[model samples]
Target: MNWLRRMMYGRYGSDQLNVAMLVLSIALLLVSRLLRIRIFYWLSFILLVLCYLRMFSRNITRRHEENQKFLRYWFPMRERWYRMTDNLRDCRTHRHFKCRNCGQKLRVPRGRGKVSITCPRCGNQFLGKT
Candidate 1:
């Protein structure tokens, strides 16, 4: 059991959203089984495997194409996973700033907007409005 945990621990990206995908994939597989949906099992299982591979896989274009072809067969569920992975792979970069005093990074999604933040660690204020 401990070995299984250790093995799977770093199998995917360590983030809230990525962990959510792993959990949701498991739930989807189980639900598909309970509902006696044969295609659902395959779709969910494939999505689960791809989701794990994403942790190490690069060149998202191939994955996106594969997922797109898979989505043609299963529209609803597969589409969601496809879009989710797509969004993760293709995210817009925003202006990011950090406080030198406290080293707290702040993400401003306004695309180079005027923003200011104070360092919570040292209470040092600066004009971060980039």
Candidate 2:
């Protein structure tokens, strides 16, 4: 692996943006194959090429800037996805309610049978059945 290491010595190698691109490319490829769509196939090919180009790019500053910009958009979306998944996972054991006063989300245990919920943010009192 010495030759490979030396070849990548000054390259940007890989980052989250590259990984996301690669994953998107693969997903598109699968979709193209399953649905026989030529446009998706071409888009997947382009994304794969871009991913490789970014990986072996010698311009570190530009690659870093691109990755940072991607991250600025990715993090909040990822957090929302995680929060949604967590809520789905917790649905069996907990219940979620929104405060009518300030639109704050509140979680309560399951089977609580009409309990009073107070919003921590706005101190709004509401009744919810869990």
Candidate 3:
């Protein structure tokens, strides 16, 4: 453990991008094995190698920039995923709706019969039953 810690010192180490790469590589490898695809195997191997390269990189600034770049594109999708999961979890307690004009998502408490929903985005009013 001492040796490992010493080796990791001054390295870029792991971040969300590294973990995503690792997971994607493993998934690709599994799919390749199941489907017997040579291309997927090669792609996964390259991805795994990139993950390790990033993990052991001495260029901390470069690695951090790369991670930030990845996050720029990933954060929005991640937020949507969290929102979807939360909505699913709270399905019994709340009713979710979409605005007709702006397509904005709105949530209301369940069991509110014949309620008027005014979209905050476009100020469009619609009637919904909870």
Question: Candidate 2: lDDT of 87?
Answer: 72
Give model 3's TM-score versus the native structure: 0.68
Worst lDDT run of 10 residues, candidate 3, spans: 86-95
Q: Model 2 misses residue 23 by how many Å?
A: 0.4
Q: Report the candidate with higher TM-score, 2 versus 3.
A: 2
What is candidate 1's TM-score against the reference?
0.33
The Cα local distance difference test for each model comes to 0.64, 0.94, 0.95
- What lDDT score is found at residue 117 in candidate 2? 95
| lDDT at 70, model 1 | 52
lDDT of 2 by residue, 18-59 (tens): 999999999999999999999999999999999999989999
State the local distance difference test value for candidate 1: 0.64
How much is 110 displaced in model 3, in angstroms? 8.9
For residues 22-109, could you state the per-residue lDDT of candidate 1 as single tens digits?
7777787888879987877877777677666765555556555655565565567767899988766544654556778678876555
User: Over the stretch 1-130, how does candidate 3's per-residue lDDT look in tens digits?
Assistant: 9999999999999999999999999999999999999999999999999999999999999999999999999999999999999878899898999998989999999997999999998899999999
Cand. 2 TM to true fold? 0.75
Error (Å) of candidate 1 at residue 71 is 22
Q: Which segments of candidate 2 are over 4 A away from where they belong?
A: 96-108, 111-130
Clashing pairs in 2: 111-130
Q: Residue 30 lDDT in model 2?
A: 99
